[model samples]
Target: MTTIDTREAAVAGLALFPPSLRISALESKNFRDEVGLSVDAVIQLDEIGVAFRRSTLFKNIRALLSENVASAEIIDRNNQSWNIALDKEKHGIRITAAERTYLIPDFSCLHPNVDNRLAWFDAETKRHGVSDEDLRAWRRILADREIDDEEVDGLLKQFRLTPRYVSAAIEKSLRRKNIRIDALIPDEVTYFDRLVGKPAPEHDLKQFFEHTTKERPGLDLPAAFLLSSHSFGPQSIALEAVDPAKVLEFFDWAEHAGDRFTQVGVVECGLRHLHKMPQLAPHLRNIIQTIRSDDLTSETGRLELLCALIMLVDGELARTGICRERQPFWRRLAAIAHASVIERAIVAVNMLPDDFIAWCRQSRGLHFYLQTFVDMRREPRWSPDLLSASQLKAEFIGRIVAAAPENAGTMLGDGSLELFDRASSSSLVAQVSFPFSFLPGPLEGGQPSIATMPQEIEDNLNEMLRSETLTAKSFVTLVNSALLYPLDGEFARLAAEGLARAKYELPNIKSSDEAFHLLVGLAIVASVTRSAKLANEVKILMRAVRRKPDIEISQENAFRICLLAAPASAGLSDWGKYIGDCATELSFEDMSRDSITTLWNFIEVLRQLEPTLLQTTSRADAALQAAFACCPPEVKTAEAS
Candidate 1:
């Protein structure tokens, strides 16, 4: 059993480090003499081994050899016996008379064979085994044989520089043979024996200081420094406890660091406590404003700054003590910064036309910003300005949409439509228009040709929708607006005709497929419009289209169009025929699996608006249940779990 030191045990917990860990600090002379002489022998063995053993070097090696050195006794500096024999068979070293042998690569050398020797020593030694500090010392000597070994030599001075010590020493003894080993050792071996340490990166003086946190009275601060005017307090009072020196130090590190990752770390550390320092709000505001567009685009810097901003704004609003008026300024600053990050990312996507689809497909770090924006807008202090967020989101979406059609190279992914749901649901466009009009920039009333100028507003909106960014409510609004456009008919036909002809490859052509879907959705809206001339005609056409079988279409597609035409507000009776067809298809175990899910969502939509539909789609519901039963137990469990 090993005895553990109270202090070391406290730091190490249950795990105890070996005694060798403190070898460098050990002041014992026996350890020093034995270790130094052994190290010298190893160095000699590295040189002319055969010649040294046969001549004067043999005598020097013998002078330092103790009875235990050549014996099986394995005791460390503590005088505890560690019964382990050195293996001369391993490395071609011979020990005469004593059965105990010394391995050429023993504790004194930096060699792989040392692991076994250390293990043996550890198993046999009592009290505790050698600590890492002792091993480190041995390694250092082995790493560079030329190092002036204090531990081993210091052992000799205290124990007496006797014939045993002198003879045991691998280097020649000046007193006995009047020979200097340094002169005898080759220059090549000496040069190669020196150790080279790893170089350190440049560090600044500002990093030297460390702050200690302690509770202070009356100031409401969590802590204070003995020599400083500044103190630590809650984040909302950040401005009051401002430490210009610490903040400046952080800024200096961020500005000077070559790696963006390091700079971002510094930026985060600097602003992490901002939520606790409301007094420092002005400085925090300045920092946010000073952050460049390039830095926001940087992989490292953006997330850090975003986290800091979120904490700052959210913390301030959460506190009941803060001034209500100050909330809007923080909210607006967060909003503008959030918007700017997305705007820059979208701009970057636009610049790459040929790779636009792939570019947009990549993660643009928008979710974090959008999430922060959503959370901030949810706070009671700023909820009334929900219009501000809606408008910001709308303008961003509109700009993206308007630009898409014009930029031939830039295309959207299937997922691009999703962003539209988010934007429209937030009513970002209307909100944005409250401050700035939704209309495109123009000189007077003359409208610019959509052909020449990029319609980024529309393009970005489409991109979001195709990406599935838009919610159902927002999608409905977009479809409704598109139908009201005088050119809705032409646009719908153009999109449908493109899909019909398979004008572009599905994977290569991104924007067109979504455009086709939007057009189809718009056509549905157009047919439902209650206008003077087309209302009756549109109803007649819907009925006619339902009954007529255009040979160009499949039964599957016809049913899908019917379901598409079925509004969320449509009653169960209205969707009975379409739901029946969907159930029948699902029953046949057809390849159109996705159609079943689509029908389910549509049915769900109607169920919410028309409860009667839930009763009407009984067969559809049963078939869905059966299909789900046919799935594997794991799948069922996954769904249930």
Candidate 2:
């Protein structure tokens, strides 16, 4: 036969089967690789055969091949007929059917095998041309026999199957051989090597880590770090079973390596496993060492790392049951850590249990408690279930007072008093009763000294008093500062000037809350110092309160106004009216413990100011009783004296 006739015979042979099978056969690695034909070349040949069959060209070619060769009819599983012709030497087979006729160009390459069949199914699936029948047929075939890992890996390399197919194939192979992940543990390095850079499915990686960790009992930190570096989710591993020594070793390497990504991953892993570990001291030390060794000022991420570690340690300590044993480590951390780090650490410890706070109060000195409260006031996100801001301030200040009652006045020099004033301003309704009595009392012979007052306080007071005219706010601030600091002549002088300015400004103050704060400050100053000028100013502010009777007031402010008015017989009726208004607005249903304490202090102050009023005014009596009902039993007992 001529070359044209032979080429025509090849075309007639390939068209005997369905297009899917024909495409698969041509694309098979066994066929294409042996023939040294590129996939594109095979695709081109298939397209030519398809074109030849669609036209009348293939029929003529098949007839010419048949005249020169002998043929036999074969049927496929679909019951499709195909005529097969063999050459004289039986080296080549010619296929002829009504659909088309083609030659099996080479029997050696086209021969069907398990690998080739799988490749065909994979190709069909990739092309989106595989039918349900074909899928079920291949599934049954894959299910019935065992596919070794070598063959599966070979198929994956030859034809990059989709993730779903890869997962199913791996799962099936694992089942057929009854292979456990533990069985592969010895060759894990080899397994990871083979699959790491390849398009290995996530399911395979997840399975490897899961089973390997289970079999090994502790994490292989280096291997996990490696995988995580390659974008694997390290969190998928159960880190609770990790060996602390291995974690330390990982940190040692991470510290020297200076690989930020790996360091962060290891830190996160440590955090996740911290609470689960039986002992945390070693891990805590290692983490703190890592934080200290790193220069946080060089990078923002390092600061974030410090914050994360603080959260981890603080959260662990907040678990009351576990904090006692861990207290020394936490205290050491606070002592030696950087100032910013300690500040963040203190902010996070706001949620510590009451016992922990008390222990801290007893074991730690005044400077520690003072710094903690100062740091807490600066933190915007500070919220603790155990204590509100006001309560925390009270607790800390109470500690300072108990430690050095005589030097409590010295806190004004240290800026603690100013912090107190700012805290009170921020959450006015939640104000706790500070022991102003701890401040220097009036001397029997002379005026108190202002030498210890903070420079900022002195500067602010001097600047305000020097102004041409003080606003109502300035006057109120002056009075509040006077109330918090020692009752020095300067403060009393500022208070006098503020009251003198308020005599004009109080009439124009429209907001009842604003007017009430002014009144409360003036009256408290008047009562404490027994200043006739301030007392007259308080009376004028009270009249302003009466003029704005239609103005609304919060229950807390109303109580303050009544507390201030209770001592004066001339203001007694106004005190009862204010209490009546408060009774209607007060609801202790969701009141915080600190808020309840504050309200109880108000009642106590009223009782001290005018004991008879509580019994005489029915509404005032009822309000006091309701407030007592809501007061925590300890609060009632503590303040009863």
Candidate 3:
């Protein structure tokens, strides 16, 4: 073969050979001569992992030892034939010319490990022949020249360049000069469009994305932009035509790439290709399941990417097939930002119901999920879908009361608490189980001692006791609210003890604001349970505190004391009479609608116990009827029997 023909064939074959390995050189040319084998025949017989190697150190040194050649002028350092060697005698494969010996892989040549393998290979192959700078220099000289095949072959043999390497060098040279992929991959942007039988204007990436199909595999978008995109961010590619297995690889790169711009490109590319590629669904689902804030470098960046991915995947999953299969993915994502109990309660309440119900079904998970659900309910704005997917069954309530009733107090306002009396067939709450209590008063083992409890539980109780406005965020208030639907007397007893504790602290309370706050919580529980001792203590404390004119009582305090008339109407007549007399003096104007509703609940609960007491207390009844009389009231029954 001619020099150009031989070099081209050798390069193509070497590119296909396993890296750092080559065909075995069984014997030297002395043996070949002894066997009378021709050079062409020897070359033909070596296709089975047996062939000439890289660099200039060939097994047959006789080929380069021709008497016509002299000096290093005949040597090409860039040649590949010398790099692959048997090293059978530990001297490595060697070529001797005159007084010099060339080794198949001199210790000077670096063999790259896997991590740096590609870059090392690219560098080694491009090092001696021509630098990238020379590649640019050559491109500039050849810019206006139209070379015939003979001239091109002549240039290849002269420069010792493979056509493929020359093409790559030319692309890199142009790409460095112009920061665009078009300068790198010279194939027309309309390649896919033409293949798919569509036509579009030049370099229209959107049209390319639209017309590109798997049946017509084309150039890789990432490969084309690898060198060009360093100036801008990473380039985004619509990946409908990408192999499905590569989708995950793309995401992995996006997640772990050190450059922020590169990561941004990956997210953008994945989003652009999202719905157009169904193969990405499983990966997206897995992300939803294992969503974590710490995976990304920046929290804000993570949130931005997460929101975009969710929005894209949400559109993709609104169906009844594989889409329906990803329901846990959807439900779990409502809490993607906050997966723990405290954060979930204050931040991800929407996801609570599903987790609560599902976890409650597991024998081992019962207390963990239930405790978390109710604890979160203690936070404000925590209205949920009433455990909509599961029924409020008797056993479920029984399991709760039996399992983690201390947390049940947190479930005070939930409709499922009503189910302390009832059951259902999806899950998530309706009923007044007046005979049941979520959290019974201080544990029967005695007043809850903080010393022995878990630090978290102690923290929760202390937090509950702290009141906002002596109204909201009150442990007593929330627990008192739960007291109204006591499934047992334990809740009332608990409130009574809390009231006693407040009464002990009453005389020392420096602020009038703090003076009578605990009275409201206690009075509510007293009215629910008709506890005389709690009522007497409230009345005595209120009367004594009023004597200290600076320690005036709140209107809510008076209102709650008065609302007690319903339960105390007959048996506790003296208590009802005292509150009825105090009612007309306090104003209801500053009361919040929520507080008002709570008061009305107390009054209504009383009315159910004894409506006549409210009627007899004309002043209290008149104020309530006056305020509510102007409202467009809904027609509703009082309560269940």
lDDT of 3: 0.35
Better-scoring candidate (lDDT), 1 or 3: 3
| Model 1 regions lying over 4 Å from their true place | 1-520, 527-565, 568-589, 592-612, 631-641
Against the unseen true structure, what C-alpha lDDT does each candidate score?
0.32, 0.40, 0.35
For candidate 1, write residues 144-164 as lDDT tens digits.
442233343332232222212
User: Number of the top candidate by lDDT?
Assistant: 2
* Top-scoring candidate (TM-score): 2
Runs with alpha carbons beyond 4 Å of true place in candidate 2: 1-387, 390-451, 454-470, 489-504, 507-512, 527-536, 549-551, 554-556, 564-641
Q: Which lDDT value does model 1 have at 22?
A: 46
Summarize candidate 2's per-residue lDDT along 177-276 as a digit string, tens digits.
Answer: 4333222111122222222222223323335445534444234454344333211234555655566666656556554442333444444454455455
Clash totals for all candidate models: 88, 7, 28
Error (Å) of candidate 3 at residue 142 is 94
The candidate with the higher TM-score, 1 or 2, is 2
Please state the error at residue 241 of candidate 1 in Å: 31
Work out the TM-score per prediction. Answer: 0.22, 0.24, 0.21
Q: Local error of candidate 2 at 426, Å?
A: 22
